[model samples]
Target: MSTDTRAAAPEVRISGIDPHWWRQAAVYQIYPRSFADADGNGIGDLQGIITRVPYLAQLGIDAVWLSPFYPSALADGGYDVDDYRDVDPKIGTLEEFDQMVAALHAEGIRVVVDIVPNHSSDRHEWFRQALAAEPGSPERERYIFRDGTGPEGAEPPTDWTSIFGGPAWTRVPDGQWYLHLFAPEQPDFNWANPEVRADFLKTLRFWSDRGVDGFRIDVAHALTKDLTDPLPSEAELDAIPRDAGQHPIWDRDEVHEIYAEWRRVFDSYDPPRTAVAEAWVERHRRPRYASAEGLGQAFEFDLLTQEFDAAAFKDVVVDSLSLAAESGSSSTWVLSNHDVVRHATRYGLPPLPETVGTTEQDRKQGAAWVLAGAPEDQLDREKGERRARAATLFELALPGSAYLYQGEELGLHEVGDIPDEARQDPTFFRSPGVDKGRDGCRVPLPWSSTGLTFGFGSSSAHLPQPQWFADYAVEAQERVDGSTLEMYRAALHLRRELQTDETLEWIETGRDDVLAFRRPGGWVTVTNFGEDDAALPSGEVLLASSPLVGGRLPGATTVWLRESQS
Candidate 1:
């Protein structure tokens, strides 16, 4: 396994167990626009997040991963960044950002900011300059600008499809088509340009100098595209085995060299800032992104896509651990994030057929279901919450980092009936309503149940919140016994003590619907996925996702036990 050569931060008192705290840290993700709003402008801001630092501290997370707070027009929910070096005025000024970081640090919670190197807003200064500059100019070279293929340049340069469901190329006023893998307003950067490389290096140092702990690299795999003279057709690209080699626009071999250079910058600091890649590469190739010489960790997202099956979850954990071992780094466990359906809602949905091969496709299917306005009658909220709680405990017991999205602790479900006009995700408009997009999960959080917007802000929330959100609000859950929020607090508090090291050994139960694993320090975690309760191994009960009946773990429940010394 690869080792971190940099010295650990002695001043950091947050989980002094590992010099690289990220390895076992329970990091919470904050989608800024939906987290909290202090300005009472009906939007979440940096000041709003600063106000919630205590809430996070009590949540027992070691770190907070903030989604893009950079300047943006909300073209793509802040992913379409307009500036890399400054904060958006709508949220708060850079000073407020510094204050937010300080507040988090005071609570011993490290901060990880988002870095979108894959693309920039069409309104970004560089893109603006490129639009005004002559063809083949250095300004144009910073992005992928090319001549169209058909007569009078009417057709796009390639038959590439945007991930949002349209032509990937957009024709400029000058008749040249620019490449955008996602939205037309978000143009892909030409990583081959030295200016692009140097600018990102500068952006890294800027944040690192500001005392930010790390970065979450967005769309991390597509930074370096193989821009050959003759690009491969979509059909040709699809036929190639994913593991065979590099593709033209995703997971190219050259991407590692850029990361190696970035590693040097990451290691330059005394304690050395860290980063995790949101890479969606194949399992075998994923280790490269997690390599010690490159990005330190790769998000093991298969867990997020899973349907809470014992065998499937076990397989994911085993493969994730193996990949982390190969990369000499720790895996990251996440059940939900800003880009997908909440696990509480997902657990209630029917499992994808065996024919579905990828997590991306699985997520797309989930989104399509939501867009189709599937009736709430189909959702088993009781079963979903039970399975969600069990899954959270199962994820926490694993031998790696754990990431929790905002509002998950309260067992929030996706709001499927969001009014069409209120929808903001580019996916909805780009897909032309074929996909409802991520607005359901991005709805502003409900802090209290008394107000119309559930105390999100003084005014209405940007997206309409369902009245049922009051049932899951923090205020309501805190007052109730055995609520999802209370259970999460209990589980997280126990996790810090029970999670000892990066080691997990399967304890065969000789049953198909059960999963049992032993961690270091004699800490054991068991989950019952069968239709009926299952007998537990002999151990002292430390924590349980639900109340144990006759010392048995109920179906769709997980428990943690400590083996007593003889």
Candidate 2:
């Protein structure tokens, strides 16, 4: 490993440590339940992940971010954590987790685990104790418990609604209501409580001491709430203003203190651990989460939400890079994750609305409409695949860290045909039949063309796999040249040599459809998002998302070019 440490801003570096590993590294997210299954129990586990470490190393990702594998009741897909220090019995034992970490280190891949600090599983011991204890007790004080309004306390304490659906406040037998922003199984933690803060710090040290590289802090912005202020109406919550740190429940100024202390904990380690906040705040407010004394990075989600237009992509990228530079933190780019629709299917649809509908009802309706209309026949699958490949190349070529969700390298599309009975996301259940939820993107990945579960395991998967998945299986794609899998491998391998710059220089491509930019080392990348072919710059072809049309870049394709010597 190179020991040369270059001076960067405090938010981007840790004293003498070299922070380049995470700054430009390509990290792969493994949603353990759907990644691979080893025990034939129809669920993916830590053992399954250990079995696949070599595969991840082969894919060339510098690190792997494993989603929550903690003990939980599976409510809200394990975000409700019953235990922070131990692994879920279904996943594996603590001993197995240590072994997996060692194995991944041996393969030169770091491990980042999910940490859900905003809420604990309703089944968590503290929550259980709160349930049995009287209101106003220390156990109950750990959570956001408040007295209900109206006669006999019939009304909830506030008008807030759960992000999943229904009222955010759940009334207990004692007539006091507890706040749960997500599913009722997840009771929001009261960060005001000293115990809650201390416990989470302990959880952080437990993992870091065990060799975990970092944490993807779930609901990082929602940890601190302003109870003194009136709860925002459902409408206000729906259309949250971009104003910085003024919201009652979402992104508040107090959240930084928690992260500042966490940063100190990370800095104490021999090789300081890192953290990336899964904060959904506005672009302006996101920097605070990654400020000098806070977390190292925050997810820059503009690319994930933007349309496929070149102008729009350029604007988002430029804005994100600018914001990160201001905070002295590297921007974290991600296309898709367990929460949203897969970009492959998203790109296939007609141009998305500039803003998703304001109300939850409208948003769900719009999502259902898109999913229903996005069949292979209605969508240009060939065009979608091309654009997806091009988008991946564009994202990886940028001068910052990039995240790849599992199976995206294989070009998997959203499984829109998943049976209603098989849907597991809490949003789907909370909303009844109104929304289909995110199970479409969480379906078990296909590893082989022929198997009981496509080599996911010997038994059937927890979620049904569609027959069409056979075509995109790793076995088939590995054998084909110019496949999406190969494109990803080659692009990742080449990215290491090219992504040495921390800044991006936009090259005027003249055409609105062509987005062009230059990185360090005379490397340039161009993506043609228009309907017609775009002229390529004079250079040697380093890589192309698709074959060029008569030596010209075709629409919906991206190419990496190295400036040639005269």
Candidate 3:
């Protein structure tokens, strides 16, 4: 660590003393089912994570964000929680979870667990009780239950569609319908109900008391809904301005009050537990979720959907920093997660239109090409890997926190060929041919180059792993110099040493395809997105994503430079 402590702003020093340690931390997301399997059960468990705590600490990440490990029905990939307070037996027991937390804490790493408050699994005790209860009862009031809108109550109450694809409302035996924003197995909670609010606060305190460091709130923005009689239709929602608190079922003002109450629970902790919202609201509404009085940080998801273009990358970076400054919170950068295609493979596909994911045609094409597997001839794998490397360097150099998904360190690509019979994502079943769902990115990671499932476990993995995964296995990449795994390790180690105050100054080169910026600590980062080489700034070369072209920065490359000692 550098002894020079002087800084212009509240610097993100890699020290345990900093209360706001997450500001510049690198968090690694570990999907429990795909990360590692310790019990030969073809599923990654808390015990497996315990065995790999040394690996996480060695990766130089400050925190590990574990996806939902709660008892679930496996609907929507664990987003449908059956219990808020216990670990799923298929993954591990509560004692094993505590052991995993202790192991991580012993290694100087923080533990952040996922909290799914928006909905619960249909098998959840409360949901089951609600199902058995009669209409207009207090149990039913805990969820969004309404009478049908048509003759003989035969139609859905609203025109809203489930995110997994289908009607959001599911009719029960009592001739009443309940709302589920995701799959039918996951019912949305009635946030207006005091029981829902009180229960979530208890969940927060439960994990915090167990020494959990932070939380990743699933579906953070869509919790509170304005269930006015004669609810707004899809067309009516489209006509409404995209402002906070205006929409009927999304980004309403009441959502913030929930977060406000949760923030109080967070503050009650010793160092004050932190949280990040997985909200997909517009950039303008993002700050509301990220406010210090709320969830503390909101995921900047625009970067994940963007093409590997210099101009587009720069725009999102600038916009995120500005928003973070206004909100008095740090911004988050994540390229890939369990929900989307891995960037390593995504960058290889053809560029999407400017308004990506906004149109039905674009989304359908994306699912077909990116998720359903485009022909091998259409993909430029080598090019995509190179861009992926450059993008990681660019993202790590930015001001705030960075999130790395599991298997990304080894440069893993999407496993798009999982047989339909083995597919488990609800999106696949719900949407049929329209969407392939997210199982491609959630495949078990390859730890070694040998074995039937690339050493994922004693038995085959729950999701099949391509044989080519052997090439990018952690064991193989560890030995190869300049591999993606090594590059990530070096970047993370260097980031702590070279980082300065939370400041980003644009370095103008008068080139549209080049993006150059300097931090206050004489550290400079340059990324070239054109077909031509670009000149490097005057500084000592610290690291490069790829080899330089005759000492010039090559296209689709990123380089880190530091002020040379005279």
Q: Compared to the true structure, candidate 3 yields what TM-score?
A: 0.95
TM-score top scorer: 1
Better of 1 and 3 by TM-score: 1
Q: What is the lDDT of residue 499 in candidate 1?
A: 78
Steric clash count of candidate 1 = 0
Please report, in order, the local distance difference test score of every candidate based on alpha carbons. Answer: 0.87, 0.85, 0.85
Q: What lDDT score goes with residue 90 in model 2?
A: 90
Task: Give per-residue CA lDDT, model 3, range 485-513, as digits (tens).
Answer: 98999999999887767899999978999
Selected candidate, larger lDDT, 1 vs 2: 1
RMSD of each: 4.1, 5.4, 6.1
**Model 1 ranges off by over 4 Å:** 1-18, 359-362, 370-374
> Across residues 1-566, which tens digit of lDDT does each residue of candidate 1 receive?
01123322333333443458889999999999999988888789999999889889888998999999988999899999888888888899877887887788888889999999999999899999999999999999999999988799888888888888788999999999999999999999999999999989988987787778889999888899877877777787666665644788777888989999999999997677899999888888899889889988989898887778999998989999999999999989999899888888878877655555555655676667644645567788888889999999999999899999999999999888888899998888978757888999999999998896898888888888999998999999884778999888888889998877799999989889999999999999999987799999998998888889997889999999998878
Winner on TM-score between 2 and 3 is 3
How does model 2 fare in lDDT? 0.85
**Candidate 1, residue 352: how far the Cα is off, in Å:** 2.2
Q: Clash number for every model?
A: 0, 0, 0
Most lDDT-accurate candidate: 1
